[model samples]
Target: MTLTQSRRSGGRAARHALRSAPLAENVRPVRGGMTGGTLKALSDDEVLRIHKAALTVLDEIGLADAPPSGIEIMVNAGARLGDDGRLRFSPALVEDMLGKAARNITLYGREPAHDLNLSENRVHYGTAGAAVNMVDAEGRNYRHSTLQDLYDAARIADRLDNIHFLQRPMVARDLPDNLELDLNTLYACGTGTTKHIGTSITEPANAQACLDLAYAMAGGEDAFRARPFVSNSNCFVVPPLKFATESCQVMEACIRGGMPVLLLSAGMAGATAPATLAGAVVQAVAECLAGIVYVNAIQPGHPAIFGTWPFVVDLRTGAMSIGSGEQALLTAGCAQMHQFYGLPGGAAAGASDSKLPDMQAGWEQMCSNVMAGLSGLNMVYEAAGMHASLLGFCHESLILGDDIIGQALRCLKGIEVTDETLAIEAMREVCMGGPGHYLGVGETLARMETDYVYPFHGDRTSPKEWEENDKPDLIAGARARKEAILAMPCRAALNPALDREIRARFPIKL
Candidate 1:
């Protein structure tokens, strides 16, 4: 009987303390930006084939509707505009820009501790969505997501261990004005979390205001540029070879303002893009390659993510099946293309078509999350709390997603083959001289915290124990945790003086 066994047999208070104790950074079993890339959805030859197809798409089909400024920048960088007014890139030009594009970039957080290193197969999971509604699980209903809801979501994400970053998950429908909406979205997310934030702007004119706001938070223009805590999730292209003119302009402003950009190309198969999964991927790749060219032409080596978010459609009804197996395959395949380009890439995952956080949502969310991690996506966006095919956001789901992503990251960590991990000596000791079992052993006790990730909300109780106590509900557990976290005194994400100053100067809704 050891101290560990004594605590193990102790009541719920001891177990809670043990589970709640934080581990040192070096010893944590899974963490943000763990190296994955073990599962290849596409072979090298297949990757090459898709690469060639994408290049061909750019060379022949090209992209239409680039903003005039974008046209000038790309043209000077060797892209050609044809009589059809479509911007076409030569294979050589695409290759040149790809080579010039920034690699191994860092997405900074307000705190240095939360910075993410984006290179190769390093994987990080986080939230992203434009859900207009918030799910009320207890009421079994939904309401328009408000600025306060967005703030609460960010605050919750700030405390979740497995969620790596915070992106604006829902629209502040309460703020009717677009400019107010944009500013408040940034304000809410930034003020709620010290982690890196991702957001979007409605207009190019709002870009300078955003930069100014960030500067105020960072203390100065140079300081903000040196470590941009927020990035613009710019949907620069509208599927199937077309530039979103306004978004392209917004991209230019944010890029010149020293903000990193996510070159998002969200093409829904069967509606906005090709019905075939491979064709959808090809179009997305081509569009993002053109985006790489656009970003590099403006400022060579500018930080940008190769975001290829392709959604699936049932085809029969034409509604998006965001949690379908096809969606997972699409995300995995897009991640492979990102690896092929050797660029930091992102894709959608963990979104569920199910209206509620039920068994369906569980299967849908886990399937994509696990596959995305296995496929080594650099940024797995919309990886938590998304419901109704991304129309609704749930705070409780976000809390549970921390646990889900922890398990996904453990899978990504895989097996460590080492002398100690081999356990042959321990096996011999247990079988011969020592006890016949490995339980209660020193190695087991030592490795317990470092080698395993226990879910805070997930139950592993025996039937007897479950009956002995009241049967714990999973949703109830997550809701209680959420309430506990939200009840704590909110950490000031920006200095009190700075926050007051900004509020005085601008509309700080949060």
Candidate 2:
């Protein structure tokens, strides 16, 4: 069966399951507490307005140095481009394209039916950065990343509730080429965990390999095709500029193959792009929209995810610095634009330019991550241990990032309105001259789960008890968590033959 037919069948099954499933015990309605003031995130009207404005900006201001193919497509589709490379797109055209585009997707996991529901206000977190260096297991520091590092990262992500997907091999080990590296890494991840695995390969052969593996895992081409297990792929558009042929090809394959493509346009301010955040954002949006237009032209109903990682250049070194506050703000603002497009937004969070794990790392990661989460990005990558933008990956960072993501999830819990939350009966009982009626009430017990995200670390005991146990800091606690997870047995089972074949094909010679 074709991938489309499979998707239609799977969609029906998913709908049926959703209809029959009981209310999730963990998914409580947002209440009138911590998130009340911030509940009015973005209304439909506001979103439309911003979208209109963006269209106007694109048409009037236009962009330069955009890919020729992208420009030709846009021009042919009634968009006006100047000799100087400025393109003006009609709002109606942009809206039409958006309306025709697929807005919903289900990212498949190894467990057949296990999928990350995208379209809802559900937020998923993962680490970001182009290059990764370090991998830690238990308390031991694994100096350089290899295939083992990728497997270890997959293991860690599988156990963390906050991490909804795995993004490629954590570290690119020695493979014949980048494509082989991506395929092997993805195969490893697929065999290692049931969490949704995201594939980001630039080469077509690598992508085909990923699809073949995905088809096998899902039982058959029909079964794999029915669901979106291999549904999305990410590719980076050239920074502060345009799309390369490879990038375009990747987008085309994804769209034609019924996979969502997240087009990330990364630019550094004062260097590759305008020094101002707003200017950089404008350019990023234009660049991404160019890619979006191309995909829509190729396959009008293809899915697209808008993303950017525009950061400021360090004036002294003229290098892209992920630690800049401008980067975080750009992520938030682009998230708003993504909502305007009525598509899922992908952004970078939990990143630091710090050389090591320290206060700078903590602050940078927390601030940027929280900002993106609150801004309502659908999927924030780089959620775990990344340093110097992408040079290092610390297991401890992953643990700490999980905690930070928990807080971000808590923030998105808009407001609650259920009868149980009002606590009117409890209030009445207390008012009736009862001594601390709230102490042991059934309602209180039921509400406890909704009230807080139980931390995986930190002291919950009394002073004396705490003293008896070593007073461990956050890092120490994270170290302990990493140890515990690494000690756990692997979840996904590998076919011995396929495993052996993969190993033989890409053996590690140390």
Candidate 3:
């Protein structure tokens, strides 16, 4: 398999596409180079207003349910206990802590090519969820997700060019033990792909065990620290402004254990947060800002991604409208707030509430995916391979999402109207001095691979040509492609000794 392909271990058909498929570099958008934010969902003044409202929430309303040590950490970091005993922060305190937080973070992969620089509106899309069900696209049914499902998803994500990172997208429902599930999730993801992975720990001890496994893989603690491939996706807050005590403990341990953290504040709008989109954005921003203060208080300048993932709810039905227009606005607005602070941040995008990967999924996933990338969000989670309003994951849908995200990034890339690109000379050559067509021109051929992004499974044949080719089906194509990827031998793997060591150290169900 190519270095860019997601390498799966031990199988046939693993190398089937290696010789036939185009290189991932031929089409993948340049990292840290896309600039799509040509539209604004909220104006500068409106953004500032929301910012102040978030500050007011932290300044007056404060937050509840901080663990004893967490309370101490914040109290020492310019926070005060209010009359109601919740930790409160002044505007001055919030601003001061913002400066101490890391402005740029490099989420590294096992390979250098996969490293992502989270700065300057650089957008990266990846997987994130804890979907308990796996939607069988072929059978049109749902079943509990398993460890094998997670590994296969990782392998598929590894091969997808637009999928920038791999977070734990589905839960291993077969494993009932919390600690075992956590460790195996880490093991499965780490072995399944070399890309940067984001996952959560159910408890602090589980996080330590995962770290030990990582240290072994990297050869030492400092080695893992220097290029940490795994990050803790910690939901540090339960919305309406309260700390999740156990998750906070997991965050602290992961922080001290040399793992980076995505401090997630996913407030469901009209439910946990305010009903209005702006209010939801404000609440999310406040929670993440508090997260920043907490991270810096623990270790000044330590890497923390300010994750303000707020979802929209169709209050009429109270169902999460993740695929709706409101979700797009919420994602874009949250990205703007992240930009305001000049901190690396994350938000949810490209998620579909559709039960199947159909036209509905296409619109729902692309609308927010485009907006998030256009807004230049540093890290966009749940950008691929999710369905049923985040309750299920479909591999075929995830494969299709790679094509969708590529187009979204292309839009973010925008049009560069340089003298060469303006093509005045080429136009003149074709219009008057030449054959009056650009199709066969050298420039046209040269730019075909660079200027236009092609799809792995998209069908573009004419009706007659399609009939001649037996009418290629997109879902079937996705399924065939998935099978080919899973058939390949696992290229991204732990050393034999290390693999044995890890299995011996822990109960690795995989």
Candidate 4:
């Protein structure tokens, strides 16, 4: 062949080789636990002011409605119970507990590869919520979410590269009994994905049963404790300085049973919390600081997430405006508090008020997710597939959210300015001697996969190509990807014998 023909053939072969190459874990464009925090929602002085305000709230206002067990525990650990039945904390005691709280903790997945390291400004996105309904894309209607839907969501999340972990997102409304519901929720989520699983326990009595299931799945108690694959997403506190009675007890049990806890303080602004943005943030921070004190008192250095999930409400309607810009500020501001304490923390983001995954949903989800990542929120819960102000979970949306998160993470990864990345030498080569453009250059080919994040379902075809391919729909693309994933057998990590044993022991609805 002539020289030009040979170069064309060689270029085609090189391109094919690059396409077939495997991406090493270290060089992938984005993955879990990317460091962010470039976006400071609160200035340094502002962060300090918020800290002092939260401490004052804890010291003076205090929280009420602590359970008997909690009251005894804290009373023994420097907290005082008032005659009016409020639990008061001192600044000294709060600081001591903060020092003892775990930092830079690793949340392990069943398959060690999926473990997430939460440290300084490290970000990880995952699914979460207790939505009671599921949006059926094909039927185009809302229906009660069952255990099947929860399991299916986990199945989809398992294959998505951007979703770091799996939290029980939807409630299994089909089961009426609380114990049955909690057990099935754990079983379904644990078995559905090998990634670390999280769920809430209704009653303290069921904590051991859930731990027993974890132990059985992990081969023994020691094995499970060494790297606990499940975490308890405990809503330990109610808004405005009050402890959730039963939820606190559940948190105590889980901590003793070797389960990491997410100290979730979900207060709605203009409703359960203060209407002012700074005031809402103050309440969330104070409530979570109390949780930190509680967890450290129970067991010092216990792995607990400072989850300040303060939500927003439309002032006129008093309904939660989760998709609004105010909600993004609440979440981002809370992340600053987590950084202030130097503790691993989480906050809600990527939820939408829109009912479906339309243009509205896209803008809303992207807004908070990008802000949350930029603020360096450790665990961005409900970062995918939530709608109707968190009342509904959409599978197609969850599928599409994977693509959305991939792009968001790319932003968090930010621009690396190394000698190689500067591309000075490559630019000189192209400008000085080679082709007018850099499209077919070696530097361009080598950096293509590592320098950018391409969407799995996002349409990027030219008009002619789009027309040739029948003008594929976005939601249709997501639905097709969802079906392709679910078409395979279940991806549960539990072996058949252990799975059968757990099934026989508990009322596992899935």
Candidate 5:
């Protein structure tokens, strides 16, 4: 077998072993049980249907100006690229790529035990990356993120059950070297949290370094071989939608290494793309298809995630706005399109252009997150405090986002068909003036734990009690909560020497 095929076989074997293994002592089953939800997880038939839709759209609508390599491959495979640079593919071509695509992935963390399953219906959240500032203890925004800021962020996210993965934002401005900055930040996050660490391979050298770190943390080449790390690699396909060499290289590396790559495209409608929402989405899909083609070319069965963050440009101001309804619709539509390919879909949700925590922020976040969740996205990024595209980050915003996600989770909670939930017998009991008996029952209490997410900051008490407690604002409560979390000791295990090395590599100047 070829190297790629061999790796695929090995991955399948590893996954089987994981499924059969007894649950680890620390590993807890997802609360509220893993079954039943409004988002009836995609089945084989649903996946096939989505794939057919995507193919129809690609062939009928067509795409424009993909990379030469990607275009050449599609043309050779009987696809068509017009003189205007529009590339069109038949349903057969799309089917061939889907048949050879890898649909499931497991992401490894510094702690061998820390991992996540990326499957058709699974959903995971990570903090927004590339943000420049974070709200500090005094409620004042700072200019740059220090190593301390990054570590503290990870610790806070680790304590919250809502955040499934930790991502590296921009490195501290004080760091002299970019390579060391990226590596050190990842090492710190890996050593600081039991949650999986998410990294982006923006450059070829950084991609290699990420692999090396994974190898070291995994205990050697063999362990790394057994469990692969996950990362997202993106490319900028300006206006007409096209890929670049660097983007192609990163995809190829992920395919060769058996890593799960999230192929993300960020397009601003009316500016970098067509002036219409549908036009932007069409161009976005074209760009993603180009990346997928490159991945399939390198390793036919390589694992990947289809991601998009297409935003609309305000016609009056000429600025890209994340708060528009167009943003939410684009995310939902993209999820539908990716489903058509029989691949896991990723999208940005719970984000706003508001610079502060306010009504606009809340509405924008709720709408976007609910849309993505209902649309059946497998993963959602920026599910936290991210303001002004990539400017402000706040603890209160994060807390609010968590509450919004709780509501989204509730929406996904499919109705239970159990005899008790259906309550045919219970209705009769109530009719007989029996008080229904469920309010005081043990089952009700058991269900509450999974059914409801208690708010960390929002007032749940009576008005009198809330007033007596000084009527604290959400921001104050969130700040206090963050402090408490940072004080708690982390359970993550890292080699003493390696920990020292990472610390020494990135020290706090102050």
Candidate 6:
């Protein structure tokens, strides 16, 4: 292109950016409903093969490390403690525990609007990570995350229509102690949003403290238990058949305390787990199966998410390649396994390797998100706002990803082909009786709200109009959105008296 053309394009972009950002009209939140079993990546035979293999691994290679009490509990529940000091689950034992597992589960929110029903192939998108660094949108750099930053993330998520639930996305680096960290983490998230919150704890004792805090904020014990707004995202297992003793203890404590649990098994492939995708999945399944037995033994049919989050690694560099195509396939295939067992499950997707939310991050997040949704994943954690391969979190990225997830959910909604939707009558009227186009038709006006998804920051101006208005930067738009949300008074704040009471009771860092 000549310099004149380039100059003209630049002039148009500037003019477009100067105008007020266009907001879509009649846009509403997309609710997750039963969506899949349509796109089956694994055949029935393949699914059965993986199921059998997982059971075999559990029966033969029984988990080597369970807290002694955990072993006794499982043993009492019909699991065999081999002479080798490992607890082996027989196929019958696995089947029995599977029968005892909760089939339909609901992750409750402080508010009724944010409750997530986890039955069948229903999909819900949310944040999930422990990124130490928070992305600075204006400075274009990374900084240590703090309590305020964590609160801001939850607040930002609270406003986003597509980000259904808010998990503890970033770590509070400023807090000095683990207990303080866990308590404040809950404090920040609990106050920041009324949506279902997911958080991790470092010790078993912290469970009661967190529960106490949640109960106080939620009004009382019965009220909190009735709508337990938080669930422990506990990494109960470390790797190939070894229970994380402390996290297991936390799980047991939380379950007994009437809190739901996310039985997370995050094994890194080629390092902590097998390099082959099939092998890693088999191992993850076996580990989660053991987790079920442990949970059921503690309290039969307790609410637990079947979390099998095995990450991919770059073989040559021995580093995580969370954005790779292989990672997308891993999550999709894992969702298939979740369906095989008729269990509500969650797995990681939409985390990007890029440090910045550029073109690379956009594609990386979208690929896994779309696939995970299509694969009938019940819970899609880290579906938005994650960067640097889960090492960093960005508010702007989170806002932009709301758009990405909106589009992905549209894909999941797919096509509804019924007599009314087929539009045979409308089409005949438009083509034969009226205009050739369906431009100003009744059907078009009626389906606009139900059929279409409008993006928040996406620009739809043509080159001429763009030049006439001003060129807008997508990142800047997201920054404006973040600022707008943060500027608002906390919409999900706790009662003033209760907030002060809890702060007095605990070492409230925030």
lDDT of 4 at 166: 93
| Best by the TM-score measure | 1
**Candidate 2: TM-score?**
0.80
- C-alpha RMSD for every candidate: 2.1, 10.6, 5.8, 2.8, 11.7, 4.6
Worst ten in a row by lDDT for model 1: 6-15
Model-by-model lDDT, in order? 0.92, 0.66, 0.89, 0.92, 0.65, 0.88
Q: Is candidate 2 or candidate 5 better by lDDT?
A: 2
How does candidate 4 score on lDDT? 0.92
* TM-score against truth, every candidate: 0.97, 0.80, 0.94, 0.96, 0.80, 0.94
Q: Can you rank all candidates by lDDT, best first?
A: 1, 4, 3, 6, 2, 5
Candidate 1, residue 344: Cα displacement in angstroms equals 0.8
Once model 3 is optimally superposed onto the true structure by TM-score, how far is the C-alpha of residue 118 displaced, in angstroms?
Answer: 0.3
Tens-place lDDT per residue, model 3, 1-510, is 554333432221443344245646635334433554566888999999999999999999999999989999999988998778799989999999998999878999988888989877889999999999998988888999999999999999988878989999999999999989998998899888899998889987687788888887777899999999999999999998999999999999988989999999999999999999999999999999999999999998889998999998888998988999999999998888888889998899999999889999999999999999999888989999899889999999999999899888888888879999999989998999798899869888667656766666887657975896799988999999999999988767788998998899988999
Candidate 5 least-lDDT 10 residues:
28-37
What is the Cα root-mean-square deviation between model 5 and the actual structure?
11.7
> What does candidate 2 score in Cα RMSD to the true structure?
10.6
> Which sections of candidate 6 miss by over 4 Å?
1-29
Query: 1-510, model 5: which lDDT tens digit per residue?
Result: 689968866975774565445443334233211222133234556545544554576777666655566667667766787776777777677667767777766666555545666665566666655677765535455566677777776777766656667666445555666666666666667666777666666566676666666667666666766766546545534445555556555556555665667777787888877777666766677666655665675667666777766778888999768877888877777776666665776777777888777778889988877777777666677878777665666665776677677666666554558777776765576557766567644555455444444554667657975796698787777777777877787776476786555345443232
lDDT of 3: 0.89
lDDT string for model 1 (325-381, tens) is 999999999999998889999999999998888899999999999999999999999
lDDT: the better of candidates 3 and 6 = 3
List ranges where model 1 is wrong by over 4 Å: 1-8, 11-16
